[model samples]
Target: MRKILAALLLALFASTAAQAKWYEASSEHFVIYADDSEEDILRFAENLERYHSAMSLVTGRAIETPSPSNRVVIFVAGGKGDMRELTGSRWVGGFYVARAGASRAFVQTIRNKSGYPHFSTVILLHEYAHHFLISSARHSMPRWLGEGAAEFFAASSFDSEGGMQLGMPARHRANEISYAGIPPVEYLLDPKAFVESDREASGSFYGASWALFHMLIFDDARKGQLTSYWRLLNEGTDSLEAGKQAFGDLEQLDKDLKKYLKQKRMSLFRIGPDQLTTRPVTLRELPKGEAKMMDVRIVSQHGVTREEALDLVEEARKIAAKYPDDAGVQVALAEAEFDAGFNEAAIAAADRAIALDPSRPNAYVQKGYAQFSIAEEAEDKDAAYATAMETFSALNRLENDHPVPLIHYYRSFVERGAEPSETARHALERASQLAPFDKALAMNAAMMQAGEGKIALALVGLSPVANNPHGGELADTARLYVAQLEKAEEGTPWQPEEGEAKATGNEAKDPVAEGAAKKPTGS
Candidate 1:
């Protein structure tokens, strides 16, 4: 029955196709998708690669280039309005989602506003700061620090000579700073106040957060205060007490930030292209069918609900049939089919993808996903499970460090009501380390660790999620995990309800909260 359905879908798609002049920019840290001119796409890709380089070197972080499959996939949105409409927010110019082994972002094309980098680029840069910092840090931090640092880094620019500047005054937040007033010092230091505040206070939080961070980073008198504060917090001190110890009087610190924000000229860093060494960016006009399928591919990569999948699978099938020889098109079809509950059809499409392009990694992932979906209902569960493992094993061989397959390895056992092997748990931990920006993945691993009495490790995993400035259920859930895990470390393990593991984080199901860097209520 499934085979016949699959055949009918392909038959219906036999002559369907669409048109778009799209370009792909492949670089060390990014895979860029743009429906724009080649010259423009190339220029943007170069700037992205250089920006990535500058950030890594400037921070003295040794973040290596991700595997091809792990590079952040950036989509150039139609315009600023499209970005705003995604989350129904006037303030959001762009956003990113951090999926293990498959992070992606959508942004309005970079442009200048008032002789500075546009708000779109600022939002993108701000989100990337969250991406980069979370990937490297070992523990959670205060919400103020996270937003402040992101704001400070987001206010940046690239020059014609390939030079870059950082720490510019956040002119984007100037209005909020001037009008919304400073968020009281307690708001900056306390998580409860940060979360409980209403819309106007939220705006002031960001404005005041940036002012405080910029002051700490650039002010001579505030040297080492930021480090001291973070160290105290990490050492188990409460945030308010840490702030007092590091910055002396809280009121004085607030006053200092107000004074700093009012200054006419603020200091910033200027580094030439020589200081930001980057890998070359490769650009090409996408193949006809692949170019035509950009919209479908973008939606699939970002993930979909069953309803969304139902809506998209027909278009995917049409494109796949029109471009029967295109592996990328087949991959898109496979994902659509899988998401729409056509598991057998998904496997068939993924098989075609693998045969068409042996080098494409996602084909294996599509097959593996479908295999996992159907294995439970199979008459011979053992053989079905083994076959799915082989599919993931093939992907691991292709990219040894690919995170999803490692996560799949861990999930294969737990999902089957069996105890995971030591090897499986190690694979999951390694995946968490490689993709710490995937806060959900870390949260899952942390839960497993907490269940097994590894409280310290669990805390490390949950901290970043708790402090996520995305500001919603996921952060709230993570804070709960931290509280529980900290108590467990102190000899009181709070047992979680059954089936709570998968329901903890704000995943793709929550469209508004998934991977959002800054979600101010309004204004």
Candidate 2:
């Protein structure tokens, strides 16, 4: 069953007492449906649950994972948006905790950012770590340690094919440090001190957090002291005291962790598209001797009559109709509609889910996605475009920190007209900054650059995704444009590249020559 928490009440309730309300913000409740392919929000959530349970068991503390009862949205977008949104929002890229009155909220927005689901899963786990920490502590833990513990947990990974392996320290943080500089260990120990400094510039925070946790938990000598240190922290140890108890020579441990993270080996668990399903219920069903349920669903969907996918959605909806208040049924119906490409129908079902229980953000995302799909199919130059714009605007208003909404908004602008091309480019740039490793978003941004006659810069953007499966087409298209640009620069014009790349604007250096060159090729 799905339940939506009211975001407004959550904020008000949270303001009164931090521990009283877990998920703050009652006005922002919605159900999030996990995508059934190449992603699994529920699996991510389950992993978090396991970690939380394990930690709580080990520490003898009531570690709370984010609310499983709330409507959680799971979806992917071309990683594209402001980096600050991901890190600054405190909840983005992690299992967020928001509450309204007695209700609660959670969301997991994982994507194929590093060209690998496993890597993204690590990122999602970090968020879950935060959820577990906050819930168990029931108090605002120090940011550095809280984030450090989250990072520590996030750096661990488990896979059926590869077994269990530790993940690398956050690259985002590492990059910052490499380009900028790191703070002293003393400064990091102080939560306020760490917060005051732009630790992002040095990337030291991520490494430092991981190092501290590793030494306290794994180092041979310090391992014996973990229990006491953990107990002290749980019992509300002073930051310096915790540091002193956790590691006798905290500075040395910090240096060791930094070295360990730098040298940590990561076996790229290249999970095939097959292992990357978003449906957790289906995945969990696998162990109960019902692994084929999802397969049956998929096969059943494929074997049915024309557009069987759509029919299956209708069937799910009909089943849901039998139980008017069954949030699960409503969510399932909406999922079916979404998978079937009945964007409008899916959106309506999602809306109904919200009406039944307004705390779920899943429905909001579904509604947003449905509208986005409709906008994609829009025919009219103005009307179709306007609808797409509305969809994106609604999405952003609901969650300013979410990059997915921004990605769609930027794309809509690019598709509709060049009048806002610059604005779209800026948005895309922000997306790249947030998720520098996302290929599709980068490709789109590069194309936008090319559209603005910044061909070299566009090529630079496209270079990153030149090898991935989804990026192959984009990479080829980008290369083709680069060739055309080079040819144009050399005064030897060639035929324009096809599709969006051909939409060259008024900045053509030699339109007459370009056209003449294409004329002969047409023959």
Candidate 3:
């Protein structure tokens, strides 16, 4: 009787897995996973490309297409229930997560409860805006500006005739503005108020932020102040001071914002077909089995809890067993094992992935990271560092634009207690330039500059990060470096002791040994 019941359970499991078919679509900047119709997935990919182009034009930031291994992954669930099952969040309609050297968006094809169309696209674009801006710039803006900009851009509309409209007023946010009275402009500028606000206050904060940003972007007299304010803040000026400096008198600015929000109709930014990409989206359907593995991999990569990581690792092992020759399955197993803290097993699986498909860059990244992890704990670190450096070098040749390899290449020199050679220096500088808001890369670059006696430049580099209000360990580290630099400037002869300034954020913790293991989107 027990055997019969076990067999029945196995049969049920197989049947359930058979239903997990997913279609994949790709464009210049995105890779989408969906169980929807092929036509719909293709259209979604095209829309994403259009959105990317539109944002690039609006921000005057060039769009650098991520390598195939690093392309942003978008998972489209069939409904709210599926999304909840995938993300374990019932209330979250969509979210973007960046970790383990990859960025992904998880969303459902559901109508907005607030009566907006293309809800999934809106959320995806909002997240992409965060990703785009962070990748393009050296500093993170205040929460009010970041959230307001996201809301403003997410209110975009695309026409059937290929026209696009941006900067549309977010009606829901506008309503919230009316319901929850605006906070004082001075209070809104305070990063602490933005970060520590309760849920009710947060609603008002977002509303007020959106209203203020709308006025700044569209109001004729205030339009030019937005850029100036960002420049001031990026230079490490206090937010209140920056606001006052950029926008003249606070009282008049407040009055202008109030009057602007009261207007019945606000202007919108528009782009014609000629201004955006017109390429058709291409899609391919994965086999049912492959699709199932892809879903498991996505879940495994994003697991937050230890038990969850263990379960995902077990599930990934099963998939890897069934598809032993598949490079992707091996890579999935590697990531799951890494998440479970099985560094040796992860390295072995990554090797298998590379053996199966040497051309795939993700396996190389995983293998290098795994080796670096082991090296950090090992007695003979020199050999491991050399091996990791070789792997990263190969990856660099394969994907020249990727920041990970460059980061690791320079980091290996630092770990070995050696000054960066010109080549290493250039690699780190380029990596920082490519991923300016990546705290790990930025911190490493600043340290390298300090090592070279460029004290002033290092301080300038650390300033924007030190001023972040959502103070984490990275912010703390930045503050420490800033203090050290200030002391040096005052002829105090301060210098960071060896290994004293370890990278202290989620993406980096061990300075040279960890490299850029993860990249958080801060969304």
Candidate 4:
């Protein structure tokens, strides 16, 4: 799925100097955040609205559009470096993250120099396709099919004269297919291989999958097969079996795919006029001080060096001085102070933010984290722990799907020297489901389960990390836990030696620390 690709593609990056301003605009289904001018932001919003309409037609499902209060957030960075700073990946063109019933996208507005049409638009649409599909359908599909569908829709183009084209040849994908060769359909269908693949394999997989889907959709005889395959998958059939039934013969389907790839020219689909929409878009600019504060918050969200942290704090303070009553600015200041290790200052700023806007969850998260960090030094640590837990509890109620709040809620029980209740167990499980790639969170859940003598459940939680050949320290730790669980099952007396079952130290122990850490953006 595109969500999995987003997680794998993200990399850690140190923070940069804070941005000075950002522009904002909105449409019925989307909000645009940019460092560009208002005109450009509005144009992007219009294009996104059109794209949403087009995708709804293609999927045969009406868009499950967000309400006025919860539009998808689109962050259009000024350049490549800005995009990299926000997403933590140098090569990522853009990505979408679904969080707490909202979707957020981070992308660069750079044009491709190789004469490619709508390069940046394609990237955004690719990510949007994932968001739309996930929102409209609650079912699952194979990774190859999901990604192939995204790429297929992403290649769509709208001419200035209002012509619409779909299924255009993807040149880059073709190149990858030519050089790397096509992977077997079985390989692409295997969800495990798709998730753990290396860069080269991933490229080939994407290319081959796209080509396969392109052929199936456009080749008159195979068009219906795509829908059939998806239907079978939805009915709980195994992907391989679904493919066999849908395509009739796996060997013949593979040959057809190879034949399609070798064609020098392919037919493109024209979108009918009925599929297009001409909805009006709305635009608004953020206040100057608030815009500047947004820049500070974005910078603070990424990991930062001490120097960068101090610089961000200074920048945020300048904005706060002008907009002293702004809750967002105060929250920005709190985040920067926490990053710079000024725990008490962070707590005070967070308190101010809460006083200004009681409904904002990030402020509570920051305040709770700062309190938890200093609890050990407090004269009444128990009271401090209780207060911290209470703050996180409020945050969880405000945004139940947010993994950070749930993570802190579970960790609070551990910090308070009490056995985690069933509530804590459910909270960790939900957090893990929401953020499967977070090795630290997964480790914490597995450790807690093992501590409760649920060795089998713990091993189930650790299996993915343990089997990850490329996983570094996390993989090693997971493997160790798996071995311990297996030994215990064998009736061998085994106790974890010193440091054998130690925490990763990277767990989301504090909500502020969790927010500051590199997580998949929007997630």
Expressed as tens digits, the lDDT of each residue in 199-297 for candidate 1 is: 777768877888898899889999999889989998989888999999998898878888887788999988798888887789878888877677677
Residue lDDT tens for model 3, 1-523: 1111223223423433446557778788888877666766776677678878898888889756666656787776556665555544466566665432366677766232222446566677776776777676656677678767877888887766666788888765656777777777876787655544465566577678778888888888776899999999877687889999998988887788788877889998888988996566678787544665765665654444555666667777877888888787788788878777787898898889889788878777777877777777777778888888888888888888777887787777777776768998888777766656556557767777787777877876776567544446777788888887876753233468567655565442211011123322211
Top-lDDT structure, candidate number:
1
Global CA lDDT of candidate 1, please?
0.75
Candidate 4 overall Cα lDDT vs. reference?
A: 0.65
Deviation from truth (RMSD, Å), model 4: 8.0
Segments of candidate 2 deviating more than 4 angstroms? 1-32, 35-68, 71-97, 100-120, 138-140, 161-163, 166-172, 177-182, 195-203, 233-237, 249-523
lDDT of 4 by residue, 349-439 (tens): 8889889988866787778778778885778867887887787778767766666667766776777677778987888877766655445
Which residue pairs come into collision in candidate 4? none
Top-down TM-score ranking: 1, 3, 4, 2
Clashes of 2: 44
TM-score of each: 0.89, 0.39, 0.83, 0.68
The lDDT values for all models are 0.75, 0.45, 0.69, 0.65
- The TM-score leader among the candidates is 1
Candidate 4, position 224, lDDT: 92
Better of 1 and 2 by lDDT: 1
Off by over 4 Å in 4: 1-21, 26-31, 49-57, 60-72, 81-104, 110-117, 130-143, 158-167, 190-203, 223-248, 262-282, 305-311, 375-382, 393-407, 420-523
